[model samples]
Target: MLLALLALAAWRAWVWWEAREPADHAPAADVRIEALNDRISALRGDLRAQAQRIQQADATNRVLRDELLGMGQRAALIEDSIARWSDPDRHGAQALRLDEAELLLAMGQQRLLIAGDLDGARRAYTLAGGVLSGVDDPAFLSLRQVLVQERAALDELGDDPRVRALARLQAFTSELDRPTDAVPVASAPADASWWRRAFSTVFDIQPRHRSLAVRPADRGDAMAGLQLELTLARAAAERRDVEAWRTALTRADAWLQRLWAPSPELQGRRDALAALAALPLSPELATLGSTLEQLRQLRSVRQEP
Candidate 1:
């Protein structure tokens, strides 16, 4: 009986000890281990999050590096292109350089947009506007500057029309500079006023030769000539280049800009005709009146483009 009681007491003590020690407990042990495993799993999740952030940052850095590389190459090309552009006197170099500038600017903007740097892209395009606005190229400079100004204005306002407009303008510039022929424009010599005859003869007789870029349709020069004449005539009385300007004005497309002053020869002829008319019965006066009446039928006229 005593032995059995001792054994029972020992058994109870062992069970109590087993309940207090975590590894010795069955269901309790499993619960503690599971809690520890949950803590370790949370830690692993945090570590993975940090690693993902680092990888994303690295990817972003690589993208920025590549963009900078492209920008560097483009800058070098622009420098090379500008050597001829700045000359101002080269035949088509200005247009070519400005065209290159436009393309580079677009490429830069594209890079910015793709990188999600909208503000940076806007600034780059605005810089392009300023750079291209003052280009001294005669043919397309004014038109291009206008387009740039409009583009900048739209971009500044955050309007979405700017990109589409820019694309169209670039295409226009490409088409405008293409090569064509230079052909003669024939106007009647007899219809010319005495002074018109002197100037018109120059056009009527320009070797009828076409140079590399001169085209039969290059009315651009004719239009430019007219613009030049109007510009000159505005300051004619105050200009030192009046003679050169005046000589150029008389032969300009003749239809676009009118001569401001009557020809001296025409004035003299009119005076002579008046004197002849004053002679009571001079046959010369009758002949002169009759000639003026007939010549009025052949006044110069313009053909629509």
Candidate 2:
């Protein structure tokens, strides 16, 4: 019974030791848990700071993206300005060509209307067409067609009227320069009486119906007058003065009639003069300056803002 009582006391002592050991470890566990809690708080703070830094970086990225876009737009604008400054007259050559074409067209109209130079006017029109053809713009393409039609109109005129008139005048002048045949005088027979021969030589008798012969001095003066009239007609033709040309030709015809006896050759010369007077000095072309007008309109439109 004493041994059993000693065992019971030992068991109670062991139980008391176990319970005191737990109480001794409790403070260390509290210290470790507090340390862990502090570490978790520090981690949470770091996480929040990292999230704030990410938000700030996103805002900075957005600002940088907008700035980059603005910079790109500015760069594009600057490039365009540089290009404009570098080549101020990008269409200078074309403008010069258009000017040349306009000048040529105006020259053609003046040549045809004022100088009666059909060949010169035709050549000017052709050169204008060539200049217009060199233009690269499609807007002026119709001008080329108009120019072509003008050229065709010139072609339809055939030979130059001034040239024809001048040629005819030249031929007539050459004919006038030729020596005219003198009238043959009848002589008395070889076997006639001396008195009859003497009378024939002393007194020349002609048919009453025969016209009076012109003296050499009068013939020369008349020829000069006719030549002056012919020259006036030619000048009028060159100047494309229809009224002046007709008046001069009419005066020349009158002079011709007064100077020369009525004959086949004389009539032919009169007919030629009449024909030259009838020839047109300046032919009317409906579409002569249409191309130039159209080109000017196109230029004006292009120049507008």
Best candidate, TM-score-wise?
2
Clashing pairs in 1: 181-214, 181-215, 181-216
State the lDDT of candidate 2 residue by residue for 139-218, as single tens digits.
78888988898899899988777777788888878878865444324467789889879897566675576543467676
- In Å, residue 279's CA in model 1 sits off its true spot by 76
Give the C-alpha lDDT of model 1: 0.47
- Candidate 1 to truth, TM: 0.24
lDDT tens per residue, model 1, 1-305 = 99999999999999988776865567887888999999999999999999999999999999999999999999988986776455443435544555555664565445443443445555655665555555664544444545455445435544232243334323422433433244324454587688766767475443333231234444566445545644443343223233543443344325232211134533443343233222221011111122122212221111111
lDDT for each of the candidates?
Answer: 0.47, 0.81
TM-score of each: 0.24, 0.53
